[model samples]
Target: MALLSVHNLSQSFGGLQALTDFNMEIGGYDLVGLIGPNGAGKTTVFNLVSGFYTPTRGAIVFNGKPTRGMKPHEVTALGLARTFQNIRLWNDLSVLDNIRIAQYHRLGYGFLDAVLRTARYARAEKNVDRKCRDILDMMDLTEFVEELPKNLPYGLQRRVELARALSTKPRLLLLDEPAAGLNALDVDGLIHLIRWIYNEFKISIWMIEHQMKVVMTLCQRLMVMDFGKTIADGAPGEIQNNPDVIAAYLGDGAV
Candidate 1:
């Protein structure tokens, strides 16, 4: 069975339909890319799947369970985690705390235990600290673990956001425009890290991106959207030659 299934998902904002009859299926360990022009509703798909917006007329199934009314945090707890187009880290928080906070859902300690400083709570805290540091090391951000996000470079901040998303321990990782503000070198590094994480962690990745190079190089399958609908979907090479996709993007002057 597919890990994620979106059947005829649709969304609207005061009569402007953002997405219409959208459908997709993602398998385990897959790297899928969603791409299109600026207003093609690419991010809308991510928002719907991540539970930021309730769909207007469709259903989503994650890990064989229905996700109609689940809240964003609820969806996240169900093994779905996402990063935003714009970095959304706590500017005042250290990188360590930023990643640690996302692991709260998995911490098996009660509030009372935390307040009373019980042994179990102490163990959990130690585990969290160790895990957060380990993840920071993996992302090559251990040196910046004590620094605020705003104090880091743009690329490092993006990595920190990705680290926080990974801290959730998701089966499915959704990234929205992760390369938006990156330079060429940073984008190359981002691509390398994405592939490394997908392989090392063995997690499925679904991404919304405007960077064609990243999309073509990393994604095993590609889905293109335009005017609130899927224009084409296939392997990267096939999608590159798709006439509808070429026309939709070029006509919009997006390419």
Candidate 2:
């Protein structure tokens, strides 16, 4: 079965339609890219899928369960996790604390257990700490565990966000503009890191990225949108040559 399936999805704000009939099916270990011009509603699709915004029409089925009317945390609990276009790390918290907090939704301890400091709470907290440490180590972020997110370089902050998302143990990872502020070397490193994450975890990844080099290098398939509508979907090479996609990014004259 598909890991994620969206059918006839649409979203609107006031009089502006941000997305129209956006349909997608992501398989169990797929690495897909979504790309378009600035206002093409790429992030809008991610928002809808991640439950940040309720869709005006249609349905989303993730891991064989309907996600309609679910809150963002609810969707996250259903094995979906995402990073933002702009980094959303807790700047004031230590990197370890940030990663530790992402696992609270699954900590398996209730308020009473925590208030009384029960054995269950203790075990859960210990497990979370170990898992957070392991994740940071895996992401090459162990050395910065005690550092604040705001103190890290932009590229390392991006890694910390990625690590936090992975701490949720998501079946499908959504990365939004992960290479946004990176220099050329950092972008290259991001490509390798994303590839490594996909291979290591054997999970699906769906990314919305503006950088052509990042998408072309890391994505197995590419979906292009424009003016709240899908214009093209195909393999990376085909999308690179598609007249509709080329026209959307460049202009009709270029196509």
Candidate 3:
């Protein structure tokens, strides 16, 4: 079975339909890209899959279980994590704390344990701190670990968000527009970092990206959506040459 599967997924915000009969399957360790014009429901798909918003129709199955009404934290506990299109880091918090907070489910100690400062709580806290620090080191944000995210450079802020997502030790990662607001050099660095993450974690990555260069370089398979429907799904080379994709999203100039 695929690591993640969406069968006839649909979402509606009042009268406006944001997604319609969307279907996708992501296998273990797969890197899949979802791309389209603005308002094409790419983010909606991420939101639905990650349980930020329950679908209006159909079903999402992750690791052989249904995700019909699971909350965001519940989904995270099930080993799925995601970053946002907009940087969603806690601006006022230190970078280390931000990453540590994402590990709440892993701590496995209750408030009573925290109040008593039991050995389990102590051990869990130390383990979480060490893991967060290691993740910061990997992302090269160790120097800014004690600094607020708002004080960091844009690219580094992005890294913090990605690090926080990874702190959960997810089996599947959803990255929404990781290339947004990045310059040429930063984008190149992001591509390399994403590749490194894939190699290291061996987890499935489903990303929504507007930057064609990032998508073509990073994704093994590409799915194109427009007006709440999929226009194409194929290998990057095939997607780039697809007639429907050219007409709907990648213009003739893209070829």
Task: Point to the candidate with the largest lDDT.
Answer: 2
Question: Which parts of model 3 are misplaced by more than 4 Å?
Answer: 250-255
Any idea what lDDT model 3 has? 0.93
Q: Model 1: which residue pairs collide?
A: none
Q: Tell me how far the alpha carbon of residue 238 in candidate 1 is from the true structure, in angstroms, after superposition.
A: 1.0
Q: lDDT tens digits, residues 1-255, model 2?
A: 999999999999999999999999999999999999999999999999999999999999999999999999999999999999999999999999999999978999999998999999999999998999899999999999999999999999999999999999999999999999999999999999999999999999999999999999999999999999999999999988899988988899985
- TM-score of each model, paired residue for residue: 0.97, 0.98, 0.97
Best by TM-score: 2
RMSD of each: 1.6, 0.7, 1.7
Local accuracy of candidate 1 as per-residue lDDT tens digits, 1-255:
999999999999997999999999999889999999989998889988988888999999998889888889888989999999999999999999999999988899998998999999999999999999889999999999889999989999999999999999999999999999999999999999999999999999999999999999999999999989999999999998888898897774654
Clashes of 3: 0
lDDT of 1 at 59: 96
Candidate 3 C-alpha lDDT tens digits along 140-183: 88899899999999999999999999999999999999999999
- Candidates ranked by TM-score, best first? 2, 1, 3
Residue 47, model 3, lDDT: 91
Judging by lDDT, tell me the better candidate of 2 and 3. Answer: 2
Clashes of each: 0, 0, 0
